[model samples]
Target: MRELLANRVKTLTPSATLAITAKAKELKANGIDVIGLGAGEPDFNTPKNILDAAAESMYQGHTKYTPAGGLPALKKAIIDKLARDNHLAYKPNEILVGIGAKHVLYTLFQVILNEGDEVIIPIPYWVSYPEQVKLAGGVPVYVESTSEQNFKITADQLRNAVTPKTKAVIINSPSNPSGMVYTREELIAIAEVAVEKDLLIVSDEIYEKLLYNGLEHFSVASISEEVKARTILINGVAKSHSMTGWRIGYAAGNAEIIESMTDLASHSTSNPTTTSQYATIEAYNGSQDSVEEMRAAFESRLETIYPKLNAIPGFKVIKPHGAFYLLPDVSEAAQKTGYTSVDEFVTALLTEANVAVVPGSGFGLPSTIRLSYATSLENLEEAVRRMDNFVRSKWQD
Candidate 1:
């Protein structure tokens, strides 16, 4: 059976984040009291207006297939969003919508990468980027970033990583795992490198709208015309509108690349779920109040829980400027707890403390751990209390 599997499929690793969340669910199924901080999803329900729009669309018989790229109206809404929010303009032909941002990214990589091509990915990146590149027969060239650098790769690092085979670089602002964002000047510097090196920029801005602490989100494409042409902006309603299950995400970029991705999507998903597309339209064009409400809730949690998390013995955390995750350096904690690895520490935490967290090994940083604060304030406080007690128990000499 192993010999029968394709090499590409065999080389793939399961998403560690999902696996941890599933393990937490399994524990819960056994009637254990597990406080899951592993998943990155917002705990809020979909906004009523968005739900109402989906119902209205279905009531009006919108349960048919849309164009492979997306419906024209949805594209228009996205275009308007880019223009109004990110200050970038695009034609309908430049936008490709698919089943969630993950699918859109996979399709984009499939169209853009060839065998042995390299995509420069920063350390502490989203788990899917390297996997999707591998699935597309491309090499993932990782540029490591440290906690001292806020887990962000610099322009010099990007330039140094380039080679004859280097085709693209992925930039995820308001980054996952680390929850750090690159400033506009940092983006400009990186964009200049991309422009100079002729490398395509894959800007994953799915968490663009969840910024905090007077920080602003900047689109790498919005830096300049040359960079805009070289940039592929991947975004969706998943993070912004609490529409993760809605399965609607789109990409805007070079028309030819988008067209190729759309064609690939045509043969693959056919189109995004029709109702999701309609609901996303309302998500973008409808009242933005719900979006703000969710953002406020996340920001509030960040403010309250960050200090508490940092106060835990041997745990070091920096307050994130955006995104709902806190990636804390728990190496000291692991050492204090007599664990040889972060994975072992996380497992003990889950089993003994019943507090589920994602080990940083999956995010390419083994000395750290990621805890999502997307749940309620009560859950977050309780989870941290459990973690603090767990750490104390291990070091209670």
Candidate 2:
């Protein structure tokens, strides 16, 4: 037999979030009571108007392939959305709509990176960032963010991470796992560092609409012409309109980079599903009522669950301002409960306590765990209670 695995895949770690969620599903299928807090998507169904749009498109026979980049109408809708929401302007030639934000990001990396090039990633990042960078033959250089820093890398930290090989820096505001939304000032500082370093800025704003406590989302690309010139903004209707399955996400940036991504996507995904593109057109152009409704539901869940999660013995949690996850420092809890590490504690939660969460080791922060509030309030509360009881029952105090 010959060796077949590529170096790209041999080094890749499977998504920890999905792995935990799958284990919870398997347990649930066996008639166990499993509370899964590992999923990253919103629990709401795709909005009604978007669903109707998809059905109507099918009836209207809009099932044929769209342009490799996207349907022009859909691209126009996305352009209008960027202008309306972020005060950012982009031409059609500067946009590349791919299968989803993840795919769009993957394509962006493919087009932007060369072998041995480095991309600076902040700590506790979304799991796929580093993997996608490596898959595209780029090095992932990490910059740390402490809990005291609200899990956001400062301009100085970013400046310190840059090397001659540095090609880009990714900023995911309303960050996954951390749920930390960077303020306008924070983004400006990071953008300034990118401008200084002549680095590409990959701004992921998928959680833009899910911000809470009257906090508004800011686009790092809008910081300045200098910043926008270097930025490749990644976003989609997935998180905003509960359209995760729609497979529609777009990136906006330099025309040459966008064209290269489009060329690559044409050979890869062909076109994003035409029907889902129609749904996303509605997602951007239709009523935003459901978007807010879902955001409010998540907000309520976070408020209700944060205190309970913090109350768990030896758990130290900082309240998140946006997004739907709570990343709590549970190193003390793990130690107090006689677990050797957070990973062990996470496994015990799944097998013994019927709760499943992604350990922070997956996000490069081993002292913590991420709990999503995307489920129903009832489930969130019960999950918290189970975690509380699980810790107390094992408390070595």
Cα error of candidate 1 at position 150, Å: 0.8
TM-score of each: 0.99, 0.99
Write one digit per residue (lDDT tens) for candidate 2, span 227-275.
8999999999889999888878999999999999999999998999999
Could you tell me the lDDT of residue 89 within candidate 1? 90
What is candidate 1's lDDT per residue for 281-389, written digit by digit as tens? 9999999999999999999999999999999999999888988999999999999889999999999999999999999999889999999999989999999999999
Model 1, stretches more than 4 Å misplaced? none
Error of 1 at 183 (Å): 0.4
Clashes of 2: 0
Highest lDDT: which candidate?
1
The stretch of ten residues in a row with the least summed lDDT in candidate 1 is 1-10
